[model samples]
Target: MSAGTIALTNNSATVSGTGTVFTTDLKANDFIVVIVGGVTYTLGVKATASATSLTLITPYGGPTATGNAWTAVPNATLVGITAQVAADVAKAIRGLNLDKANWQQVFSGTGTITVTLPDGSTYSGPAWNSLTTLLNNKAAKGANSDITSISGLTTALTIEQGGTGAKTAAAARAALGAFSTAGGAVSGSITAGAAAGIAVAAGENNRVEINNVTSGVGAGNPVGWTVYRWYTELAQTGIRRAGDTTIQSYFVALSGGGGWEFLRGGNATASGTWTSGSDIRHKFDIEKVKNALASVLTFNGSIYGKKDGGREVGLIAQDVERACKEAITYNGDRKFSDGTVIPNFKYLNTAGAAAAYHTEAIKTLFELVELALDKPDDARALIASIKEQSEVIKNTPIENEDPRKEAPPIFDVPSSEDYEEPTT
Candidate 1:
């Protein structure tokens, strides 16, 4: 709305070109007259231009012919095309009306688009070229479907990849060392010729435990076989026998067969040329071997007791070996009777002291001294008491007894380490 004017004439004589021209600068709300073919009309000018040929526009809702409908000003915006322009024909012809789409219509694309309605909220859609319009139209209720808008999708999209769900949480836990099933098939590689010791619980299935156990490192894993094989080898080698090789391999093979062999090694009397190439027999089987060697070392002997000649052996007395063998036989050592190897000795020696003699008599003497020393009284007191008691019993007369019978004499007490046998 400003000041200026344009003149228009149908005849060439009145106007410069056959259009409108203005005689003077017209302020806003100015009016002009035009006569064409003897018909005079008044035109309300809304805007004026200063070009050689003036241009003017008619303001909206200014005036119109009595029978003709008013056309909207060119390029003019209206509020809520749906409600404002209720006529169907007017809305249909309107360009770029967003409500041209229904409530369920969704526009999707890239870039920016501004949507202006006649009277409703102002929204933005993408520009014509930058964005794509995805209009989702859903029915009343045949299926529950509605159009929803998704934002923040990038321009370049690859649809082939699917979501990898919950991977972050899976990576947070600790790893396990070994896995096995109670009864499932398993396979793995074992080193050849690597020795390993194995212990299988008794009463388990009596079958070959490991696969390919011969001559391989796996020979070490026969579940209680090492003792027999190792000792057999040591025994044969210690005696410098040719059978040592056979003994070693035999024990290795026999381990799975539940065989155990016990052997002792040391210099002994040569039995028949002391055959350097002969194999000696080990005294135990697998089961017994496990028990005996459970505590004894093949080379070192008993763990708790001293070496073979130590106190638990025959070191305490020179005659202990003879005594042990005799006692063993006297008690029917051939076969256990009442689970005893030797009969308990309790009687008199030839000198008639309350005594029991061992085949190795020194052992009996040591036992007697040990028993005496184990008593509460001092050694001197005990010895003195024994002497006094001996005299009393020796001198006392037996009532109603023949005087021709001689009294029994007490044998001299044996010393623990050094003792002299009484002379007749």
Candidate 2:
């Protein structure tokens, strides 16, 4: 049944039609019979179809009026009835509902079906394929296609799990620095080669040989190899606080019942400990005494003295003040005839001033020593100055004396009678 209308213009190739006979109802290449202007024509074949229009291969007779009745016609047949029956049979087969078993029977033969993946890899096999096998194949293809063997691995290797790309070993090493060689130096269970000479054990018995050769030929000189052994031990029983711990405790422990002597020095803590054999103790003693003498020579009245309640001795503030006062020279005030008292020369009574004075005194004393060694004339002049000061001190009067001509009487008598009245 058709409820279609065609409105054609003067053109004979295309006719505009509005109808229910479009793609849903009629397919391309389908023939339709139309009657226009009361003339019967079987002229148009559907080239394209839409809901409201049909594009025909050849337009119907031009200027056809609207409301033309049209009907879908069976394709023209070669043998008339046979062709029509065959077409009907084909349409019936297309509409039939075939179940899975019937479809399997129809597609029973094995055939190759190729499928392409997103990564441009293809899989070819029967339609039914193993999911696991397909996935493994995809992974293998990805690994092979993306990257082959990576090169340029030498000094080190970096296995970066998540980053832009693989980094070179040298680049990683440059960033992180070299690994420590201490791990390689460790003695393990693996044996050394025979070319390594003798293997040294981890004890005092381990020794290295030294070769000594004489250059010139003279009398045969004695060549001897002496091995000196020094042993020390430090032991403590209980835990101690960091502030309470001292070097003396460690020294006592390390001495191990030997005759130990302490050498005082500029360093408050013990510099090092010595066992019985070496001259470290003597060397330390010399250094300590020399340093002590130096300190005394430049004393400036300050000494490393003990605090009132504390055990350790150091330069105290009061002592430093006293040293400053002693080292600086103060000039007395001058009085002029005009009755103006000029102030004494001002000097800073400070540790820095004291140190400067001490340094100057040391320098002067050293100059005197140099004079005594090399310049006798300068030494004599210095000695003369000392003698002149000594003479001035020697001649100075100890007590004041009266300048009167006659000796003054000790007691005053009230004339001659004052004494005579006292006799009664």
Candidate 3:
């Protein structure tokens, strides 16, 4: 609040001031009025303020004098008015009787405002209702209601908003390495193990080994195999072994029951290949395949050049193959030829081969049929013969008995007339 008096130094360019003046009290490009030898001179620029002494851009043109008053000229517009004058003006505006007719003469224009006074007090302008409505629409927080702690803020602060606080604009950035200044190249490598490996870069061949990875192991099993342990053994693109260009990649694995098997990689031209391993054993159930074939094959006596007695003819080799293709369920390795992959039943391939294999296959099929048809009749005949033999044994007489003699009755029955009437 005090406008200090200037004490001119021996040098006309430098002058000292009294009463709470410091280097921060003035800034560059500020207009200052100084009184020297009862003559007032306005300085265009205030170069610096240092501990009550001021160095000016242009020196005073009069004799060096002590106790000369110096005052900083205020800016023209009130938009950026100093906090000191703003507080005083706000106080004066609040003290005015705004409802009086003279107050209307004081204000040339009509506008609403919520005047915040110097003593932390507030006054509503002429349009109190509209001012409050506008203030409500502004969504401005109260002075104390505004956030005090920044712990909840997640966004980076701006330079005007106190910045990151770790570095300054004037600080050298060489410690960060490789920073350019005005198109000049600044180059450096971040070497590893220099400062406890904190800024170390990973090497080209450096690998992070994940130890003891047993993702799919059973309980109490050894922890050595990773989820991709099988994949790591094979090359990603081509074959690994020498002189093996056709075989792209492969992996070998042990079964839970201690059996080993080879797994072939997929053909990119075709669909993927099945996984290789002893645990991947998936065979067509022989019994199930036989049952499925038997259910479709039938013996039609009229089809094979016989009206009454003919060989089984309903199921030809082609029909059996078609039925096998439709019915058979298998997950084993298949021989694929430029066609749809199907359950490979080698016996059902051709008529000649089928007939050859059918002879063997029908041996079992005929056994099933003969057991179903002829065995029941044979069993019935055996049962009938046993019954006849049992009847003959009952009709035939004993070896020591006479042929003409009659057997004695077991007991005699009395006549109805000889029987006396019994009491009721």
Candidate 4:
């Protein structure tokens, strides 16, 4: 026995041999992995040892049947190993190995797979491949292609049912139908107002003027009416368009006869049916009316014949008063022929300042009358004193030229002409 050789443990002894120093040969707790009689076993530490023989026990395994090796612990879960290999292969295909140098070394350097490429070159490691193939495989086709054609494309490129997706290239290339008519269209409804005939003649300045009227000559009847007639030569300001001109001036006088009529009445002057009493009410205040007319003495080339307002106002008042008085007569005791007591008639009651104006109109008339004809100052004074408020008084008589008197025609030619013999 070697002197230092000692028991390693309670179940173990260390021994030396003559030719071998066991201390140099033996190790503690190291399995002696050995094939014995074609059976493999992992021998535990020798509990006791003498020269060539030792005693040991196998803790993890006994041996294989024909066991050349212990079967590698059934390769430690074959399904799991297979799955790991498959995952590793997929990663390798996706170039995942490039992300890890260790994985690249594991696959590319000396290992189970000494993988060589088809080109007789070994795979060094992961290399980048083009995404073009993957892109092509996942690319979208148009409406005509199968469902899988759009599998991996963006949502904007694909369409589901009832989608209002924009037109495709082929669809846009298709022909469009023609428009219904040539130019752009318009909606219906449009036209004119009144008819043409019986429209008033132009240049009448849209009014009917009458002068030189024979009594009872109506406004529209005999083609020619009085000059200086009220509505004649009238102008309607700002009325444009032919139809507007006609209506503003001479509208067909509406009558109970259900036809067109004219203005004026029986035989007093060239007369038609005149407008109502109100229409000519200003005639009652004839002085004011005539003054207003005479205010615009000359209108568009026609003379007013009223040379002055103060004179014209007086003459017009006298004319109206004379006409009214001639129409009615009075008897003794100051009663009218119909036996009604006559009442004094006055225009624009002149009790105060009005009295002064009334006196002025009267004075103006007497002055005009004197101017028109030769009269004594006494006659003029007598006519001026005639109180318009009460009655007409006269001392020295006065006369006036009749407005109605007509002289013979200015140009006269004899019907027979004196003829000289024709001299060559």
- All candidates' TM-scores? 0.15, 0.20, 0.17, 0.15
Clashes per candidate, residues 3 or more apart or on different chains = 30, 0, 2, 20
TM-score, predicted candidate 3 vs. hidden true structure = 0.17
Ten consecutive residues with minimal summed lDDT in candidate 4?
291-300
* Candidate 1 residue lDDT tens string, 1-424: 1223223533212212122233343433444444334455544445445322333444322222222211112222222443466776665655335555422233443466456565556786555445333322221223445425334434322223422222332321212112332222323432334444232222333322332223332322222233223322312111111233222222222322323222232213322232233243653342211111111111122233422222332222112212222212122212121232222322212111102232223443354588667863554564565455444433444222112323333446643235333453
Q: Residue by residue across 295-401, what tens digits does model 4's lDDT show?
A: 11211222234211211122232333332223222232322223343233233211222343345556566666776477567655544443432232212122332
> Which regions of candidate 1 fall more than 4 Å away from where they truly are?
1-114, 117-121, 126-424
Per-candidate Cα RMSD to the true structure, in Å, reads: 30.2, 30.8, 37.4, 32.7
Candidate whose lDDT is highest: 3
Worst 10 residues of 1 by lDDT: 288-297
State the lDDT of candidate 3 residue by residue for 1-424, as single tens digits.
Answer: 3366777654477767776364555666665676666677766545655657767777766776788767775434222565668888876776554334334433542465454444556665655445444555343455889744443345545545655432444333433332534333623332223112211123453322222333333332223221212322311111223232232233323322222222232222213344534342564443433332232333112344321223434333334444344322335433332232324322233343344435655665565567558688765564455455434433444222122323432345663335554454
On residues 65-145, what C-alpha lDDT tens digit does candidate 2 reach at each position? Answer: 666667766554324766789998886665453334334533552455554443446665554334443444332334447
lDDT of each structure? 0.32, 0.44, 0.44, 0.34
Superposition TM-score, candidate 2 onto the true structure: 0.20
Shift in Å, residue 203, candidate 1: 33
Which is superior by lDDT, 1 or 2?
A: 2
Residue 372, candidate 4: C-alpha displacement in angstroms: 99
In model 3, the runs with Cα more than 4 Å from the true position are 9-11, 20-24, 74-424
